[model samples]
Target: MKRSGPLLTLVAGLLFALFLLALNATTGTRGASSYGEESPAAPAAPASASPPATRTAPPPSQSPSPSTGPVPDAGYAGRTDDDSASVAVSLRDGRAIAYFCDGRNKESWLKGDVKADGTMKLTGRDGAELTGTLTAGERIRGTVDVGGARHGFTADKAVKPSGLYRATATVRGAKLVGGWIVLPSGRQVGILARDGKPSAAPAIDPSTGVVTVDGRRLTARPVAP
Candidate 1:
């Protein structure tokens, strides 16, 4: 019986040791799984930084805007398209005066204001009118109307000694009024009116602007608007 009890105790101790080993194996597996779940994965490398984008400039324009401005104060002179008349214009302080003459029997005087856009409108006696615009070439392009006749004219900018002139005198108890247009070529065309009668005028020195009419001396001065 003693031998049987010792054998039974040995069997029980062996079973208990086997149970402890099985329990330790289960706990080790569970701890290993928990540690793997808690660990974090490394962050993926940041996407390589992209280079700054390049920008291109636009091309320049081929055509440019037109020139524009106000009319300058000066004198302009030219002939009619038909070569039948001479026209003279003077501008001052935004005001304008014009004269149209055929140097023989027909003459008209006009006056008006110059616009900021370089346009002009002038009227005279006997249904006479003139309209013109300043152009890029520093010329006045316009049409003149006199005695029911319309004529186109282009007048260029006039420098010194190439402009309008006027003379007034009395000869033989008659009032004599003269107007002259001295051109850039030093040639001049004028008309003399005696008591409202028109006639071709005598030549005058452009430098001195003086003329002798019927033994009387008269000074021809520059005309202004």
Candidate 2:
């Protein structure tokens, strides 16, 4: 009985030690090394980075002003003649910015690019601006700043309204005729294009085979009769 008692006590001591080791393992696993019971915390999401300079808003690019190079558009083919006037075009936002003209020669007209809001701008020949805008029907009223003085100029493209005339008047109705008709070139176009009146404007020149309305020669449209 005494021996059995010592053996049982030894067994009891061993079981107690084993129980303490198990408790310590479980506690550590929960706080630090507890693989089964603890979960790793998630890292915070990084902040959204701004776009690169190339992809982000960039500085506006400067477009070089147009020059007197070969005209790039067919719309200008017959706009002016060598002895006539020159016209220039400027573009601010792709549409006609401004138009400049000098009637004495073909080298005079100039144009610039227009802004999105119809504001026109350009680089001037003398490094200064000569700009204008049309306000009324055909009236172009604008200014060019010379040095520091503002010079205002007003002009209009002439248009002819019809006068009194009928289709039956072969030659005798000047007062009954409408206004004169001219061509785009120096040559005249249709004789009866005016108010169907017989015109005293000018006779068709047999030498040049060209017609005229009033005194100015026509140039664009073909003349009838």
Candidate 3:
């Protein structure tokens, strides 16, 4: 009886040890699986997106325009062959104003339009007319018609001392008109008229604008047309 009892106790101790080992093995496997599930590897980082491209504009261009306007005209003066008739002309912006006279009674104020080609046809009182061409270097060649008489003439450009001058006064109950032209080269020519009749003119001072015609002292003045 004592021997059977010790054998039964020994068997019981062995069975208990085997059960503890099996339980420990199962616990270790479960712990390992839980750790793997809780700490999964971090997902790969997403690639960074690129910035949008920028664009630029261009500049404008520059250019020139053309011109449009009429050409200007110039001045001129001269006398006839016999020194009996004189002429002076002033031109501006294709327009012309002229004076024709013989120191005595015959005189005319003329006006007209000049062409781009320098051609001109001017008319004045008493059916007087002048047709001319303004040549290069400020020269004028023309034909003048007065009272049905035609005369050819050539005149040069008038400058400073060679410009047009005029004088006027009442003498002996008559109106007297006079004109003097002092050439740039110091040459002088003049004409005087009383009541529309041609007569001789007196000596003139170009610088002072003084004149004496028919015993009348008159102050002449420079005229720009």
Candidate number with the higher lDDT (2 or 3): 3
Tens digit of per-residue lDDT, candidate 2, span 1-58: 9899999999999999999999999887777655655676899999999987775688
Minimal lDDT window, size 10, model 3 = 64-73
lDDT of 1 at 20: 100
Sorting all predicted structures by TM-score, with the top scorer first, yields 1, 3, 2
**Cα deviation of 110 in candidate 1 (Å)?**
0.7
Task: Provide TM-scores for the models.
Answer: 0.70, 0.24, 0.59
Model 3 TM:
0.59
lDDT for model 3: 0.76
Worst 10 residues of 2 by lDDT: 159-168
Candidate 3 residue pairs in backbone clash: 103-191, 103-192, 104-198, 104-199, 105-198
Scored by TM-score, the top model is 1
Candidates' RMSD to native: 10.3, 16.9, 15.8
In model 1, the worst 10-residue window by lDDT is 61-70
**lDDT ranking of the models:** 1, 3, 2
